[model samples]
Target: MTTWVLLRGLAREARHWGGFPDKLRCALPAGDTVVALDLPGNGALWRERSPARVEDMVAAARRTLAGVPHTPPYALVALSLGGMVALQWALEHREEVRGCVLINSSLGRFSPFWRRLRPASYATLLRLLAPGRAAIDRERAILRLTSNLPLAEGTQQAWTAYALEAPVSRGNALRQLKAAALFRAPAAAPGVPLLLVASERDRLVSVECSRAMARHWGAPLRVHPAAGHDLALDDPGWLAGLVADWKTRVS
Candidate 1:
């Protein structure tokens, strides 16, 4: 049985994944397991200082799982900045990474800064950059930028509460962003199995980033025609289904 690890993006915690982890678990084989981990400075580990480099983040993740019951090599399913950490993990510790599914992620080596983080999102992103913004307002701005589809009732309120309970420090948020901005994937594809997933309507990041990564890495690519950057929030079922089908091939 495979052990699947879920990782979220910049300034986000495992809680941001909402119900997607459970949905994915249901889609997988009965014996398989799913574990959602919080990067340093986010979720349960919010008190820890976030590393400014992606490689350091990988080290932190390895440390987080050390001596845990779950076994490696792990199937890493990650989003945005988490994707960068997964790629670096596979490259640095190939034996411990069984496979990777990078969603709505980009590589500095393959895409320009503008496309990596679209110009259209600059305003919304800037609003979130303001320190001391109310949790509900911040979450609302994030939702506007990341999701194009209708949300479930109370989604916004719940996200607001999550923000208040385990708020990401402004310094930590900037450090995470710096890591994401500086990370450059190796020119060669990672040795492990890989998949690239993108959202056609993503307002924050250009879809071409994923396409470029797929072409450069010679990996399979899947696109959701209407999903936004938060594909899990927009359509968890579709993401889960794709992972289920891809798991069979990779396994």
Candidate 2:
């Protein structure tokens, strides 16, 4: 059986993938399995201290995979902060990964605004901007910052609920922010097949960043018009079909 492992972004839980696995299972050929993982310090692993670096997260993922019945050679599909972890995994364990899909993420934090801000300043800004009740009310703003999709009523509600239920702690959020600011792609690219998916309207990581990674890795690219950073949630069917088609073409 073929396995596809889905990884979510920083402070996000496995549930963030939402209906994506089911949609992909329906779309993918028989014998393919979709596995959604909860990174350390988030979701099912929330009790753990969020790792400060990509290497620690990679180690946790490796340990998680080790518990699975199947071994190595899986497709990795990751988003945002998860994409960073996925990229590092593929770089260090290329032999274990058959394919990789990085969605709405950059090799490094793309914004000069973010890069210029000191970690303390960034953390303060984030905390100040993300106040209670107001945070829920600012769903559109949050979506704009986090995803490439236009905010719909349902999307807003769902995201707000997620934020309320699994609020990433300030410390963890700051750690992730710092990590993003400092991150850089490895000198050597992975040998496995790669797909770079970007949201044209993404306010977080610019589409140009995705394009750069694609160019650097010689990976195929897919751009979703008007889709915000959370492309999978916005249109899981589209993403599933794209992955299925890529699997067929690559096979």
Candidate 3:
């Protein structure tokens, strides 16, 4: 069975994956196991201090994977900043990472900052930078920016609970953002197979970043014509389908 290690983006944890894991399982070949891990200062590791550097975050992910009982040759599936971590891991530990699937992810070394994070999102993002905001309101704002799909009141309520239960402190969130900004990928792409997925309608991250990154890396790009930045949440079926197809081709 192939092992898939899933990682979420800035200020988000494993629980944020919602029903996407199961959707991926259904799409992939049978017996493939999916494991979602939380970075420090998020989810299960809420109280821990998050690393301010991307490489250190990669080290922490390595440690977390080492402690878990799993087979070797993991496929890293990550979104946004987590995608940055996955890219680093694949390059640093080539033998351990068989492939990577990057979603709405950008690299400082490849794209400009404005494209990595769109200028349109600046005002909303700045408001979220400070602490003391109500959990529900924060989730609502996140929902608006990240996903185009309509979220039910109950879903927002659940997200609020997750936000409250293992809050990513404003300080940690900014630190993570700093790490993402500082991370510069190698001039040459890693040798491992990579599949890049992007959402055309993404509001937070410009889709052009992914397109240009794919062009530079020589990786295949799959565009979800109308999804938002949170492609998994906006259209998990399409995302999972593309991943499964890519996996089959790579295998």
Candidate 4:
């Protein structure tokens, strides 16, 4: 059985993936398994201090996965900051990773800072730092910045609940940001197979980041015509289908 590891980005936790994991599980082969992991200082690991380096994040993730009953040589599906960690993992432990799929991810060496994280999102990101901001408002602002399509009716409420249940401290948030900012992927691609997925209408991060990485790595890229940075949330069925197809070809 192939084990699929799902990693979310930034201050987001596994719960933020919502129904996407289930959708992917169904889309993959029946015996395949999906595991969603929370990075340090997020979700179930909220009390932990976030590492300032992406490599440390990879180490922490490996520690967490050691507890799970999964086989080696897993497929990694990561988004945003988690993508950096995934890249590091593949580089550090080539034998343990079979393939990687990065969604809306950017590297420092690939694109400019403005393109990596669009200026349009700076205000919302800054406002989120204000004290006493309600969870619903924070989640709403994030949704507005990251999603191009309308979400489910209670998406705000559910995300707010996630925020309240496992709040990521501001310090941890900054640490994670630092990790992302400092990370620089190798000029050469990792030895394993890679797939880069991007959104043409992303508001938070420029699609060019993925485009540039794909060109540099000579990896295959699939662009969503209307999705946002949160491609899985915007069009999970499509993402699932694309992954299913790619996995079939690579496997």
Evaluate model 2: give its TM-score.
0.85
Q: How do all models score by TM-score?
A: 0.97, 0.85, 0.96, 0.98
> Model 1 Cα displacement at 133 (Å)?
5.4
Model 4 agreement with the true structure over 71-98: per-residue lDDT tens digits? 7889999999988999999999999999
Give all candidates' CA lDDT scores.
Answer: 0.91, 0.74, 0.88, 0.91
- Model 2 alpha-carbon drift over 4 Å, by segment: 109-141, 147-155
Write down the RMSD of candidate 4 (Cα, Å). Answer: 1.0
Q: Write the per-residue lDDT of candidate 1 for residues 1-251, one digit (tens) a residue.
A: 98999999988899888789989999999999999999999989988999999999999999888958887999999999999999999999999999999999999999999999998887776654555547778889999899999997888998888888888888888899899999988799999999999999999889999999998889999999999999988999999999999999876
In candidate 2, what residue range of length 10 has the lowest lDDT sum?
A: 115-124
Pairs of residues at least 3 apart in sequence or in different chains that clash in candidate 4 = none
Q: Which model is ahead, 3 or 4, in terms of lDDT?
A: 4
Residue 135, candidate 3: alpha-carbon lDDT: 73
Query: Where does model 4 exceed 4 Å of error?
Result: 131-133
